[model samples]
Structures are given as structure tokens and as C-alpha cells.
Target chain A: MILTVTPNPALDLTYRVPRLLPGETHRAAAPAVRAGGKGLNVARVLAQTGSAAFILTTAGGAPGLRLADDLEASQLPSELVPVAAPTRSSVAVFDESSGETTVINETGGPLTPAEWTALHDAVDRLVVPATCVVGSGSLPPDAPDDVYARLAAAADAHGLPSVIDAVGAPLVRAAEAGASVVKPNRRELAETTGLDDPVAGARVLLDAGAGLVLVSLGAEGMLAVPPEGEPVHARLGTPLTGNATGAGDAAVAAVASLLAAGVSDPSALVRRATAWSAAAVLAPLAGELAPGFRDVESRIETG
Target chain B: MILTVTPNPALDLTYRVPRLLPGETHRAAAPAVRAGGKGLNVARVLAQTGSAAFILTTAGGAPGLRLADDLEASQLPSELVPVAAPTRSSVAVFDESSGETTVINETGGPLTPAEWTALHDAVDRLVVPATCVVGSGSLPPDAPDDVYARLAAAADAHGLPSVIDAVGAPLVRAAEAGASVVKPNRRELAETTGLDDPVAGARVLLDAGAGLVLVSLGAEGMLAVPPEGEPVHARLGTPLTGNATGAGDAAVAAVASLLAAGVSDPSALVRRATAWSAAAVLAPLAGELAPGFRDVESRIETG
Candidate 1:
């Protein structure tokens, strides 16, 4: 089974407004709430793809309980580590007119040292039989920036492959800790490698101990760079456009699924991963690979 | 003891941002949560003013529980009637640069007939030896528009003075039920009475069997029109500039306090009420009267 960790999870509240006036009152035409975090998104996508994935997250207070309740209502399997402070909430205001999304992210609750240890313990318990472990999203307050690195190292020690989807110092640390795979978007790749070109940045991550590197270029498609293999290009078979909020998570899930299924070819993994990411954009909510996504997946071009 | 009833209360969440850009993600610099509703605001102000007001509200689900917890944390007295769904949450996004507030209000949980009967029973229980009973805000779903009117009639039957702060058809029904006092802002008064002039609107409400009519004219102060006494005008002697979100509720609290204190003159009541409303703008949060707000009471100019 795949184990997904979302250290800083949230109850994401989305408001739909016709227009957002700076200082004027705008009523939300519709509102929606979802349990959100990068790892949660990955797990959700895995579930949609008919994979057995368990979500481990830290949730607290009423919002946290509500988040857990929502996951249960959605029939998503999850185990929550309770905390004292309320889980942070992220507000996503969607403008249907321009299809632009503005996100207001809350700095999530701080974790106690014991809570962090509890998380490590949970990871230790899951790693014994897990084929793969996925760590995602930002580090909450009181957590070291290298927390993901420690988790990746633990996965490595347990002989389990790890997928790291994060940015900045954490991404650097995860690479140094020998993450099996690292997925970074174009902008993140630029920041991580200080390279103007994403292909060059993917090469840097590959050189930095990541066994495999996947670079997402939004509508342009994806590039896969392996430590010893030639880089492969994957493109969506058709032009599809929609919300891209959780596309990266979908890519990570696809890579994990392919790895777990014993697909060792980087070209085949990149082809499948890019198709999944594109399918996620077509789905309204994050993590769900669109229906007939496989049909679309079969048509993706791997060059 | 003042009995405050909030037919539709909310858990108000305020997000402060430098500016709000439509279709773009904006992070909140600061976020705060508070228990909110017009009657809840009145109860909070009354509590701060050393009045032991008993809040009668339908508090249920997670948000309702949070609101009750907040009230308890504040040491405010309250009696809650449980409902089926969670209370609504209102989002107020304040842009500091433009000093503009955008409100996204959610329709609160609908009360079942059983819940409405339960609330009525609770009101009946309070009818014995009541001083002042206040019903405020919009009617919740599944509840009749005449809910406030019925509550007012119930309070009158028990020789309790009823103060109603609502708008449109609810205010008209509340006044027709012979509310002792009905407070309507200029815009609400115009909407209710079909009169553009607030003074004329006040007279219309008074003619509808309201014992006293209080029309709040933002910045200009308040107008008090009683059944037998001549109309009294109270202008702001001191220029006050602040958020007017809960100013009307603060004014209601002031009127209740003066009535409890046995202030018989409409002119004196209007002066104290307007001053308190002005003081509300100075306070950062709703339901909090500014320190030394009582001092402004004497500055009110009555003509």
C-alpha cells in the first residue's frame, strides 16, 4: 500500500464570485469546502486510479474534525493525528469570468516536538510493508525545513521508494536524502537549480541524488530526466485546459503507481504521468483522474 | 435581565489583506474569528456594559459549537437551542489600502418546525419576569418572516418590552405586532416603509403600531419618533470614523441599557443610543464599545 504524508493539511474553502472589487462587498455565488494538502491530493488521485493509498495527516480543532469528517464522507481512507490548535484554512476565490484563482493561504498550526515524533513513529509503522511513501506540501511552524529529508531517508532505510513534491530548501534536502523521485514545476525547477531552462534544472536535480526527476511545464507537457538514462518528453494527446490546482499531485501519483506496478522505464513513467496530470486539470476538484483518463493516457505521445 | 434572540447568527471570519485582486490569490495578513449576529452583538455589548444579558440562539453543528465556545470563553451568558445544521459563516475581507470591506454572507442553516417550536418554548420560558426581550437579524430558512413578530407579541403578552432590529418585511411585521421599539437604519427604513426620507419612514413604522421608532442615519446620528412625543433628533457632536458593521447593534444595546436604567425621555434615549453607535466604530471588533464610550454619551446633541 502507498502511504501519503501531509504535515500541513487544510480545510480549503472556495468562493465563486462574478467579480472581486478591492474594497467593495462581493457576495459568493457559490461556496465549496474540501480537505486539502499536497499529499492528500496525491492520495486522492491514487484512490481514483484504483490504488490502495492511506493518508496520514495532522488535523486539529473543529476545522480539523470537519476535515476528517469530509474525507470520511467522501469515502477516502485517512488517519488523523490530533493537535490542540485549529488546522489552518486556505481560501480559494475563483473568478469564473477570467478563470483565474486567487489563493489566500493561512500559516498552519505549530506542531509540538512530541507531535513531530508521533509523525515519525507513524511513518515508521507504515514503512515496514509500504512499497512507496509520498511526502508533500510546506513545513508547518515548529517543523524543521529538512523534515521531508528525514522522512525520505527513513523511506530509503526501509527499502521503500519515496516521492517528494515540495519546493525550496525542503526540495534540496529531499534530493540530498536520496528521494527516489522529485517532481518540480517549471518555476520551482528554476528556483531549485538557478537555471533559466527547465531541462537544465531537471538535470541538476538528477545530479543531486534524485534517482529520477520529472519537470512539469504546465500546458507544454512534462520532461523526465533519469540518473543514467536519456531524457524523455511526454505530451498530452489533445489540448485540454481547466483548473491546474492539483495537477502536480496527479503526476506524482501516476509516477508512484507506475513504480509500484514494476514499470522501471523512465519513458513509460513520463508518458503515463503527464497524461494523469492533464486529466486532473479536466476534473473539477483535485486528485481525481478524469473519467476515460486512461483512454486519453493511451493516446499521449512519448518522444 | 435582557433576553437577546438571534434568529440567524453566524461565525464571522475576517481576513485582512493588503488588497483584493479578482481572479488572483491573495494571502490574508491577519485572520480573526468572532461570534456574530445583530442580537449576538447586542448581547456582547450588554455584557461589556455590566448587563447580564441572556442570549437565546440556535447553536448547532461545528460552527455553532465554536460560537458557543467563544461566548463562553468571553464569559458571556447564553442559552442555546440546538439545530440540525451547522450555523453559517460570514466572510469579511478587509482591504487595508482602500479601507474597503467586502462581505460574503452565507444563508444560515434552516430550522425545522420542531426546532422553531423548541425556540418558541425557550422564549416562553423566558417570558416570566422579563425586563427587555430583543429579537434581531434576518429570519433563518424554514422559519416564517413573522417569527420576530410572534416573539414580540409573546414578550408583550408577558409585559416585557420588545426591541426589534430587522429590515424589510420582518421589521414591518415586528412593528405591526406592537414592538415597543424598532430600530431601522436609513436604507432599511426606506426599504421597509417605501419612503426615501428616514424621518418619514420612522413615522410610517410608528403609525404601524410601533411604540417607538429609531432610525439610524450613518454619520448624521439618529432620529427618535415616539407615539405621543414629538420627533427628537440627535446629531453626532464629535466626528466619528470607523467600521459600521455592528454600529446599529451597538445602538440597540444602548437603547436597551437606557430603558433598563429607566430613562423615560425619547430624547435622552436617542442621545445615548447614537453616542454608543458612534463609539462602536472606534472599537476594532463588532460588539465591543470603545473604552470611555460612556463619556461620548454626554456629547450627543439633541434637538
Candidate 2:
């Protein structure tokens, strides 16, 4: 079983409008609401791929209750640690006319020290039954930067591999804590390490004690950098173009699934991650792969 | 006491962002939330002016619960009729850079026949202690156009005057049901009645059995057209500028307050409504009036 920790969970609302005009009023149909977060998406993808998964997250106020109800309705196994502040909401306005989307994300309130303690304790308890631990998503404002780092160390203490998908200080901390794998998209990689070169940026994570670093390059596929030996490159002959919002999470899910089964080869992880991410691009929405994803791995080119 | 019925109440969320760019993602501070609807705004203004006000509205789902919680926290007296469909949410994005706001309003789910009947029954029960009945706001997509007309007719049945603030067919229906006062802005009036001349358009409502038609003319103030008297025009000497979103609701509150107190003179209602609407413009948010609203009435020009 894989255990996923979402630092900042949200009740995501997607509104569909005929057109999007700046500074104008729009009347839209009721939005599509989903229980969402990076880790939750990863867990969902894993579960969809026939892997048992458990979610550990914090929730509060009315939106939190709605998120809990939605998760239960979707039948995702989870435990929510209650807090005082209401959970944040993410609104996406999809314009049918231009085929574009505009999003607004609420900055969630910082967790209290007691809430943080409860979160760490929840992670400790939930991680006991898992073969792999995944900590993903943004940290709440004023939250300690070592949140995912602490999760990595906890997973290390329990002799389980950990995958950390984060950005900025949290991403560096995850690497420094020696997470088994750290996945970051190209933009996040450049911004976090202040290096425009992907290889040089991945090296920062590898030097910081990460066992492996997976860099998603969108249509170019992925790059895998190991602590020792040469980095591996994997890609599909033809890139799939669709909704790429969940591609990164799908990649992380693939790596975690492999690591959970004790497959740590850099090339093997790269091929699977690339294939699953491409599959994700072909599927509309997030957390699901295309139906023919089985044949994708065989077609992936790795060097 | 005044009874304000909101047919389509909403959990209004306001997000403040540094700037707004079309087709771009924004990071916003936590939204400012309030229980909102035109009728609720009218009730709020009435209460602020020391008029006893009661709210009758339908609520459902999570946002409805939040609306009820917020109303309770603010100490507003309200009775919520439970419905199967969740109440809608309206989002306003305020851009600090350009000082403009973009709004997205969800078209609320239509109430079932059972739900509409329950709303009417709830109104019957709640109207016993009120001196006036006020029905305001948009009708749900599939809602019968006579929702406010029915409210007006019910108010007449109880010998209570009604003030309706609506648009389109609902406005026409309210006027046809012989509402004491029907207030619509110049634009709503022109669009609903298909006449560019405000006086000629208002005449349509008067011919439809409406006792009085009050047309809001933005900075030019308000026009009160009574069934038997010549039209009275009232405007402030100098228009105070601020947020004008809630100005119309404030006008409705003023008229309802006067009618509840047995003051039905067209000139008196016009002066009070003009002053209160101008006071609302000077305030920063909806459901509030500037502190010196009493002095505002004295500076008004009536002709």
C-alpha cells in the first residue's frame, strides 16, 4: 500500500463558461467539484492502477467537510486531521470559446504548531501500513519548509522509500533529507536551483542526498539522474497533447509504484514514468491514464 | 418589521488579487465570504438603520450551511427552508492594480415543485409578524417567473406592502401582481420593458397594476412614478463616488422601511431612497451605509 500526504488539500471547483472576458460578469452553470491536492491526485492515480492507497491530510471548516464527503463518495480510503481554519478552494474557469482555462488558488491559512504536530503524528501512524510514502503539494503560508523533509526522514526511519514532489525550499529540503525520489517539472527545477540547465539542476538534488531525481520535460518526456553513473533519458516517439495538468502527478505515481515494489533502477523508473505521463496527457482531466496505456511502456525509448 | 425573501440566495466569495490577467493563474488571499442575495442586502441595510427585519430564504448543500453560519454569526434573524439543490455561489475577483472587479455567478439549480411550494408555505408562516414583504434577486434558471409575483400576491393577501427588486420577466410579473413598489435600474428597466424612455417604460409597469415604479438612474439619482401623482425626481447635489454595487438594495431598504411605517407618499419615499442609495455608494461594501446617512437626505434635490 502507498501512503500519500497532502500538506494543503482543496475542494477544487471547475466552472465552464461560454467565453472569458476580463473585467466582465459571466453567468455559468454549476461547477464541477473534486477533492484535490498533489498527493491526493497521486493516490488516485495509484488506486486507478490497481494499487492500494491511503490518504493522510488536514481539513477544516465547511469546505473541509465537503472535501471529506466527496472523498467518501468517491470511496477513497482516508483520514482527516481537523484544524481551525477552513480548507482552501481552487477555482478553475474553463472557457469553451477559446479552449483556455483561468485558475485562482486561495492561500490557505498557516497550520498551528499543535496542528503540525498532529499532522506529523498522523503521518507516523498512517505510514506504518504502507510500503512507500509520498508527500506532495504546496506548504501553507508560514508553514515550516521542512514538512516534506520530515516526511522523508520518517519514511527513512520506517525503512520505506519516499517520493517527494514539491518546489522551492521544500523541494531542496526533501532532497537534503535523502528522499528515494524527487520529481519536479522543468520550470520548477530551474526556479528552485536557479539553474537554467536541467542536468545541472537535477545535479543539485542528487548532490543534496536524493537517491534519484526525475525531471519532467513536458513533450520532451523525462530525465532520470541517479546518485552514481550516467543520467537516463526516456520519451515517446510521438508526444500526446491534451490536458497536462495531472501529468506530473501521474509520473510521480508511476515512480512510487515501482519503488514500492523494490524496483529502483534509474532507467526502469524513467521509462515507466515517461510512459505513464504521456498516457496521462492523452486522458482528459487528471488522475487517470488512457485506456491503451499498457502498450505505452513498450514504445518508450530510453538511453 | 420587514420580511425579505431571497429566492436565489448565495454564498458570495470575494477574492482580492494584485492584478487580473486573462488566461492566467492567480494566487489570491483567502476570499472574503458573506451570506449574500439582494433581499439579504436589503434586510441588512434595514437593520443597520434600526428597522426590524426578518429573512426568509432557501438553503442547501455545503455553501448553504456556510451561509447560515455566517448569517448566525452576524446576528441576522433568518429562517432557512431546506431544499434538495445546493445554493449557488458567486465569485468576485477584485484587481488591485486596475481597480476593477470580474464577477462569475453560478446559475443556481431550479427548485422542484415541492421545494417551491415549501418556500411559499415558509413565507406564509414567516410573514405573520411583518409589516412589509420584500422579494428580491434573480430567479433560478428553471424557476417560474412568478416566484416574486407570488410573493407580492401573498403580501397583498396579508395586507402587507411589498417591494420587489428584480429584472426581466420576474420584474414584469412582480409589477402585474400589484406590488407596492418595484425598483429596477435604468438598464434593467429599458431591457425589461423594451423602452428607452424611463417614464414611458415605468408607465408599462403602472399599467400592469403596479402602485409605484422607482427607477434608479445611477449618479442622476432616482425617479419615483406613482399611480395618481406626477413623477418625482430626486438626486444628491453632488454624487459621492465609491462602490455602487449595493446602492440599489439600499434604495429598496429605504422604500420598504417607509412603507412598513405607513409612509406611502411618493415624494417622501423618493427622498429617503435617494439618500440611502447615495450613502451606500460612499460605503466600501454591500449591505452597509455611510455613517452620516441622515444628513444625506437633507442635501437631496427633489423636483
Candidate 3:
């Protein structure tokens, strides 16, 4: 079983509007809501692919209650550490006319120290039965930047490999903490490492003691850099044109699944991650893989 | 005591964004939430004025739970009728840079027949101690258009006056049911009665057996049309502007308060409603009048 941690989770609401106009009033039908966060998306994909996954997160207030209820209805196994602040919501307004979506995200929290401690305690309790540990998404403003690093350290003590999918200081901290694998898309890598070239940006993490760095290049696929060896690059022959919101999380799911099963080959990780991500893009919503994902692996060209 | 019915109550969420750009993603802090619907807004104003007001509305699902919690926290008297469908939300994203707001309203409910019957039952059980009945806002999509009319008829049966603040078919039905007062803003009147002239449209409601018609003309103030007397016009000496969203509801609140006290004089109703509506415009949010509302009435010119 893989254990995933989402420091900040959201109740994602999607509304379909006839058109979207700034500074105007719009009336829409009831929205489609889901329990969402980067780690939860990864866990959802893992579960769909027949892997046992458990989720650890914090929620509070009405939106949190709603998220808990949705998780229960979805049959996803999760432990919600209650907090005083309400869970935030991410609203996506899809314009039917132009097929464009406008998103509004509420910056979740400045979790109290006690709330953070409760979350850490939950992770400690749940991590024992997991084969691999994964931590993803943004931290609350007041949360310690070394949150994922602490998770990596905990996983190391447990003799388990860890995957960290995050950005900014947390991503850098995860690398420095010697996480088994760190995943960041091209933009995130560039921003965090201050390097425009994807390979150069990934090397910074590898230099910081990360065992592996997977840089997602969106339609172009992915690049895997090892501490010692030539980087392996892989991608599908035809790029998919669909919702790309969950592609990165899907990549994390693939890497975590392979690592949990004791697959460590750089080329294999890159190939599977690329195929799964492409499959995710073909699906209509996040946290879902297209039906023919198995065939996508054959189409990946690795070097 | 005033009984207010909001067929479709909402959890109103207000977010302050740095700027609002179409087809772009924005991150904002947590939203301010309140129990909001037209009738609830009316009740809030009445409560603030030291009047006893009771709320009757249908709520379900998580948002409903939140609304119920908010009403409880507000210390307002209310009875929430449960239904299968979830209550909807109205989100307002205010752009701090431009000082403009974008509103997204989720059209709530097509309440089941059983749910509608339950709502009617709640009103029947709670209307006994009410001095006046106030039915406000849009009915749910599947609800009978004569919902407010039914409330008026119910009030008549109880020897109480009814104030219907609605638009379209519901507004027309309220008038035909001989509601003591029917209030609609200029735009609502034009759309419902198909007349550009406010007085002419108001006259239509009075001719439909309405005892009185109050037409809110926004910054121009209000016009009162009594069934057997010349229409009275009232306005502040100088127009004060802040937020006009709650102006009409404030006007309805004023009329309800006056009628509850058995003040049936058209000129008095026009003067008070006009002053309160102006005071609401000067207030920053809906369901609140500016601090100097007493002075506002003294400044009103009724002719």
C-alpha cells in the first residue's frame, strides 16, 4: 500500500457556464464537486490502477465536512485530521461557448501549530503499513517549509522509499533530505532551481542528494535524472489534447507505484510515468486514466 | 413578529481577489460567508432594527448544514425545512484593483412535490404569531409560480397582511392574490409588467387587486401606488451611493415594519421605504442600513 499526504486539500467545484465575462453576473446550474489535492489525485489514480492507497490530510469547518462526506461516498480510504479553520474551495468556471475554464483558488490556511502536530501524528500512525510514502501539493502559509523533508526523514527511518511532488522551498528541502524521488514539472523546476534548461534544473536536485528527479515537460513527455548516469528521456509518439490538470499527479502515481513494487530503473520509471501522464490528459477530468493506458506504454519512445 | 419565507436560501460566499481576469486562474484568501437569500436579507435588516423576524426556508446537503449553522451563530430565529437536493451557493468575487465584482449564482432546486408540501407545512405551523407575512425572491425552477400568492392567501386566512417582494410570474400572482403590498425594483417591474414607465407598471399591479405597489427606482428613490389614490413619490435630497445590491430588500423591510405596526398611510410608507433604501445603499453590504438612517428619513422629500 502507498500512503499519500496532502497538506492542504480542497473541495473542487466545477460550473459550466454558457459564457464567461469578467465583471458580470452569471447564473449556472449546480456544480460538480470532488475531493481534490495533488496527493489525493495521486492516490485516486493509484486506487484506480488496483494499487492499495491511503490518504492523510487535514480538513475543517463546513467545506471540510463536505470533503469528508465526499471521500466516504467515493469509497476512498482516508483519515481527516480536524482543524479549526474551514477547508478551502477551488472553483472552476467552464465556458461552454469558448471551451475555456477560469479557476479561482482560495489560499487554504495558516494551520495552527497544534493542527500541524495533529497532521504529523496522523502520518506517523498511517505510515507503518505503507510500502512507499508520497507527499504532494502546497503547504499552508504558516506551515514549516521542511514538511516533506520531515516526511522523507520519517520514511528513511522506516526503511521505505519516499516520493515528493511539490514546488518552491519544499521541493528543495525534499531533495536535500535525500528523498528517493522528486517530481516537478518544467515550470516548477525552472522556478525552484532558477535554471531555464530542464536538465540543468533537474541536476540541481540530483546534486542536492535526491536519488532521482523526474521533470515533466507536459506534451513533450518527461526526463529522468539519476545521481550518477546519463538522463533518460521518454514520451508518447502522439501528444494528447485534453484536460492536463492532473497529468503531473498521474506521473507521481506511476513513479510511486513502480518504486513501491521495487522497480528502480530510470528508463522504466520515465517510460511508465510518460505513458500514464499521457493517459491522464486523454481523460476528461483529473485523477482518471484513459481506458487504453496499457497501449500507451508501447507507444512511449525511451532513450 | 414578521414571518419571512425564502424558497431558495443560499450560502453566500464573498471572495476578495487582487484582480479578476477572464479565462485566468486566481488565488484568494478565504471567503466571507453568510446565510443569504432575499427573504433572509429582509429578515436580517428587520432583526437589526429590533423587530422579531422568523425565517422559513428549505435547505439540504452540506451547504444547507453550513447555512443552518450560520443562522444559529447569527442568533436569528429560523426553521430550516430539509429536502433531498443540496442548497446552492452564490459566490461574489470582488476585484480589489478595479473595485468591481463578478457574481456566480448557482440556480438552486427543482424541489420535489413532497419538499414543497413540507415548506408549506412549515409556513402554516409558524405563521400563527406573525403580525405580517413577507415572501421574497425567486421561486425554484420547478416550484409553482404562485408560491408567494399562496403565502398571501394564507396570510389572509390568518387575518394578517402579506408583503410580496418578487418578480415575473410570482410578482404578478402576488398582486392577483391581493397582497397588502407588492414591491419590485424598476427593472423587475419593467420585465414583469412589460412597461417602461415605473408608475404605469406599478399601476398594473394595483389594478390586479393589489392593495399597494412599491416601486424601487434605485438612486431616484421609490414610488408608492395605492389602489384608490394618486401615486406618491419620495427621495433623499441628495443621492448617497455605496452598495445598491440590498436596496430593494431594505425597502421591503421598511414597508414590512410599517405595515406590522399598522401604519397604512401611503406617504408614510413611501417616506420610510425611500429613506431605508437609501441608507442601505450607503452601507457596504446587503441587509444593513447605514448608522444614520434616522437622519435619512428626516432628509426625505415626499411629494
Q: Native contacts retained by model 2, as a fraction?
A: 0.90
DockQ of 2: 0.72
Top candidate, metric lDDT = 2
- The 0-to-1 C-alpha lDDT of every candidate, in the order given, reads 0.85, 0.91, 0.90
Which digits, one per residue and each the tens of the lDDT, describe model 3 over residues B5-82? Answer: 999988899998888877777988888989999999899899988789999998988889889999999998999999
Per-residue lDDT of model 3, residues A59-167, tens digit only: 9888898899899998989999998888889998888998777889888977998888888888888888989999999888778988999899888889899999999
Predicted candidate 2 versus true structure: per-residue lDDT over B172-193, tens digit per residue = 9999999999999999999999
Give the clashing pairs for model 1. Answer: A102-B24, A102-B25, A103-B25
Model 2 interface root-mean-square deviation:
0.9
Docking class of 1: acceptable
Q: Choose the strongest candidate by DockQ.
A: 2
Could you give candidate 1's per-residue lDDT for residues B1-303 as a string of tens digits?
Answer: 988999788888899888876655565533687888889999989988888788888887888888888888877778889998788888888878877777877777689989999999999998675688899887776677788898899988987788899988889899999998999888889988899987778888888889899999988999998887588999887687778878999999988877766664788879888988988998988898999888988888999
**lDDT, residue A220, model 2:** 94
lDDT of 3 at B43: 94
Candidate 2 whole-model C-alpha lDDT, 0 to 1: 0.91
Highest-scoring model, TM-score? 2
Worst 10 residues of 1 chain A by lDDT: A21-30
Model 2 chain A weakest 10-residue run by lDDT: A238-247
- Candidate 1 on A1-303: residue-level lDDT in tens? 888999999889888877655555565533688999889999998988889998989998888987998889878777888887788898887767777777888878789888888888888888787888899887787678787888789889987888898888788888989998898888888987899787788777777788888888888899998887578889986788787889999999999888777675888888888989999998988778789789878878888
